[model samples]
Target chain A: MGFFDKLKEKLTKTKQTIIEKIEAIVPVGKKIDETTIEEIEEILISSDVGIKATEQITELLKKRVKEGALKDYNDLKLLLRDELYKILEDNTSLNLSNKPSVILVVGVNGVGKTTTIGKLGHKFVSKGKSVVFAASDTFRAAAIEQLEIWANRVGADLIKHKSGADPAAVAFDALEHAKSKNKDIVIVDTAGRLHTKFPLMEELKKISRVMKKSIPESPHETLLILDATTGQNAIRQAALFNEALGLTGIVVTKLDGTAKGGVIFAVKKEIGIPIKLIGIGEGVDDLKEFNPKEFVDALFD
Target chain B: MFEALSDKLEAIFKKLKGKGILKEEDVDVALKEIRIALLEADVNFKVVKSFIDRVRQKSIGKEILESLSPAQQVIKIVYDELCELLGGSSAKIQLSPNPPTVIMMVGLHGSGKTTTSAKLARIFKKEGRRPMLVAADLQRPAAIEQLITLGKQIDVPVFHSFDLKDPRKLCQEALKKAKIDRMDPVIVDTAGRMHVDEELMQELQYVKEILNPNEVLFVADAMTGQDAVNIAKSFNDKIGIDGIILTKMDGDARGGAALSIKEVTGKPIKLIGVGEKLDALEEFYPDRIAKRILGMGDVLSLIEQAQKAFDQKEAEKLKEKIEKEDFTFDDLKEQIRKMRKMGPLENILSMLPGANKLLKDIKIDEKEFVKVEAIINSMTLEERKNPKIINASRRIRIAKGSGTTVTDVNRLIKQFNEMKKMMKKFKHGKGFKLPKIFPF
Candidate 1:
């Protein structure tokens, strides 16, 4: 199956909450009305597209309706597609423009941070790029071993430290090793859950600074992997990481789960960070470049 | 999506602040706002409808509360109904009078079954019970190792086998080992698939049959929103769950699952994983969750004054100062310093209703607090006593001394003013702004 088809199948759970509901409301050629717009608004919010983004879409739909441009719910779908795409406009593509680019993966614990890094490494290896995996998530138990297993499977070199070692030191060593080995990419896997309950993770900041010591332009892309099923709290997680690390892109994972992953629009709308990828399944092939058109299309499909 | 629910309510309440007599239309507007907020937060539409009905019945044209404003009574009614929807009271983990209360942790992969199993052990350990972690999740490549490692950190013993692949057999042996070791609670971390499938369910059924766990915690991710509810229902129907453990709770604030899980699946959320650490687990309280739903957490702290035990004289003086609108940046700085020493500033700030709005909107952390602390400490005694005496050059000096940006210094003073404004409302008992402030 094609990637989009796979995404569609995986996102069936997500689609259940969105397209299914919308289609049920505005089938084939139903005329749009006030109640229809309200139902559509509720659907958008239910999918976690968020209030602001949903309001933006409804606002546009209302304007179109007022202008006599939207005669039916069929026209409403086109308007939503246009408005949703606008929120995701940015540097959405992975910036592989620089060789030996350092990719930093960060997220809260249990958001598949390590798995996404492993999957990314596998993708790079398949594309004929020499990749080195950094086990900077040394705080999480057996995080190194888990990454090491992925490294071995993908034929990528892994730079790791003993469990519980300073994660920043591991990241720094990995960058130095990647540079020395002339690796095409260095994937730095930071611990998702910092030991400190304190919200500010100086360690994350410290790691970024230490990587610059190895390569001034290290960490070229810092991608935050968020869970697809997350609700309003996704904003808090995204804001913290985005503010602290100045995140370049975002990847919403576990799209296979029964959630439209509408928080994607929320993150983009609230933080203005382009979502670069989506994780639809557990396999290495599940990570796909986030296409806004395709994503919003899939939401209604 | 996180604060969307409370923020909407806050907006509505803000409008209703000085409306002495809330007309039916006013209540209608508030209910409509509440309905949208709840639905937006991913609360089931049916549940939201019923909740609105309950709040409307109690609040519409109720002139009984003479001391309280109409908006305050409406919020109180909604809060009480929300609490009822959230399982009324906390349903704690069912501890067996007999030792070795088996807790079978089951959920989808990446739902945090293993880590929460460890967290459960830690919570039980804090209660002086010997908890053993059973690594039944041998399906994942390193799930066993992950559980064992988490076990070591928490000083709990882990039972896992290299050869044993069948979780049923592994759990049986682990239960026997727990009994032998006199462990009070044997936590069995079961394997999880990407989605609910028959094989995984049957295997869990086997393990559940063998262990006869006292509690089968359906570990669900809080971020999953409504999906968490459906997954919980699936698990509860297929394998039967005694309760739920909502993970990554601190990540998102909407807590749609917290509302939906109990109302839809008929299962209480026993605990919540506030953070990733094993010790990050907190007992789920309906009152607290309800207050959070209404954005009343900060108002609770402000009204309860549990932290007032720190300095009674200072507390009384501060209350009087706030009532008389005598609060200043000096008092603000001192209160923040004292609050930081007492507990997390969010908890202290969350006590004040408006503080939550400001904190939620602003990206402040401990590092900012450090900068705030340094800026205050750098000030002379006079500056500390009277922040009004400080000027731009003095701010630059303080920033230079503290090694912080001017924005940091500015934020401190700005936050100080906001605190004073909010505290004045709290002290007067004039029903503060409906949405953000405590309904006094």
Candidate 2:
């Protein structure tokens, strides 16, 4: 199946609920009133679309209603899809200009950083690009082993140190190995840490800095993996991680669950960090490029 | 964006403070602000709607409106409702009358189940119960290894079979082993799975049927958004969870998921995972969490932690030294050590009322504590007791010994003297200020 078709199928639960809730709130031929608008707002908010983004979308609908552009529930639905799509639309490709381009994956504990790296490795390997995996997550128990399994599965070379060793050293060694091997990409997996932990954040910064020692302007892409189930704190995660590492993009994971991944809209609206990829399932091939138009159509169509 | 719900409520109530009597409109305005704050905290919109409706009904009553200090009354009503909704008080895991009580941990992917299972085992071990960990999570790569590693760290035995692919069989065998080994409260760490996956959900159901776990704790990330309700409801429907465990509570997330899960599943949050350490598992307190969600600060938890960290005898001796105005670098180092025992300084500070706003601008460098300890350790006994004896030469030597600059040593000495003076002033019934030696 095509990635879009798969994404639509995976997101069917979220889409059905969203569309079903709106339809249930207001019949197709019925005019959208204040009560209908409030109910729609609740549906979006409940989906983790967030208060700010929902307000923005609702405000636009109200404006369209005053201008006589919005007539019925169908018109409101179409307009909502378009506005949501507009907010999510952005450059969703990786910047791989440099040889052995470093992609640093960072996030709070349990957001699927290692699994996403495994899938990303599969993608690059499929494209005939040589890849090196850096198991810099030297904190979590068995984290390195987890990444090692992913590396072996995806046909990528893994450079790891003993658990509790310096993560920066692991990243540095991986970059060196990738350079010596003349690899096309290096994926650095750091330990899952809450952004509130200052010492851990500093450690991540140190890893980023040490990468520069091997290749100037290294770590071309610093992606923060956000769980789709995360609420408003996704914004905080993005803001802090961006401030600490200048996050280039985000990879929202676990979209196969009931979560609408609506927090990404808030993340994009507030932080302006584009969503580069969406993890639809637990399988290695479930990762797909995020397309805003298709995602909206999948929700409404 | 990081505004605590308490700060927003404070702003709203500040306007209502001068009003002699509450009007319906006044209550409506307050409830509106409360609704927004709750929603911002990631409370389910339906839950928030029902909650606001209840609070509004109670707040706009004739007696409440006519009561003096109606704003405080309204605040009290809201606080009570929140506390009640959060399970009234802390709920303890129900221990089975039979030995080898089984606890099955279930949650979506990345919810800290494996880690929390080890923590739970550690807690049971500390309570003098022979607890065993069962690695039933056969899905994720290296998950069993992770559990085994954690079990080794806590010195608890982990039951696992590399040959067993079926979790139901694995759990059944683990339980039989636990009974044979006299291991009570067997914690089964299940693989994290999406609730929408039917096959996986049915797998969990079969395991649940076989295990008949004493406690089926639904582990969840504290930062989970609106979907907490759906996930909790599905788990409760499928496997019938007994309680909840919210992980990563150390983060600054408002943790509305706790409230949402409690509301949806009617399951009490039994414990919370506050840090990465094996001992960081804490018994959940609904009042403290309610206060945390309302942005009112968790003073109760802070005090409990402080009491746990500080020795009463040591505190009495420190108090005597402070009264005598003879607080030395040795004493300061001892206090710092005890303070370190109470989690991170930033985390402790965050429990203070209005500390979130204070912490927003100031970066608390935890490494400063290490530096202070090093500088103090570098000091000789005589120099530590008598700061006057530490001359420029001694300061230089100490700086070199501690691998710090002379300026840093001088600053510490100066601050130590200033703190002594402030203690004296405090004894003399004057306002006291903390010494600026440590970075905020």
lDDT for B16 (candidate 1): 81
Candidate 1 wrong stretches, greater than 4 Å: A85-91, A193-199, A296-301, B1-11, B39-42, B62-68, B195-199, B292-440
Per-residue alpha-carbon lDDT of candidate 1 for residues A103-178, written as tens digits (9 for 90 to 100): 9998877788888988898899999999988898887777788888889988999898898888888888988787
Question: What are the candidates' individual DockQ scores?
Answer: 0.34, 0.80
* lDDT of model 1 at position B91: 83
Could you tell me the lDDT of residue B355 within candidate 2? 78
DockQ score of candidate 2? Answer: 0.80
**CA displacement after TM-score superposition, residue B116 of candidate 2 (Å):** 1.2
Model 2 chain A: lowest-lDDT 10 consecutive positions: A256-265
**Range of the 10 consecutive residues with the lowest summed lDDT in candidate 1 chain A:** A193-202
What's model 2's lDDT at B90?
85
Give candidate 2 regions above 4 Å deviation.
B1-3, B426-437
lDDT of prediction 2: 0.88
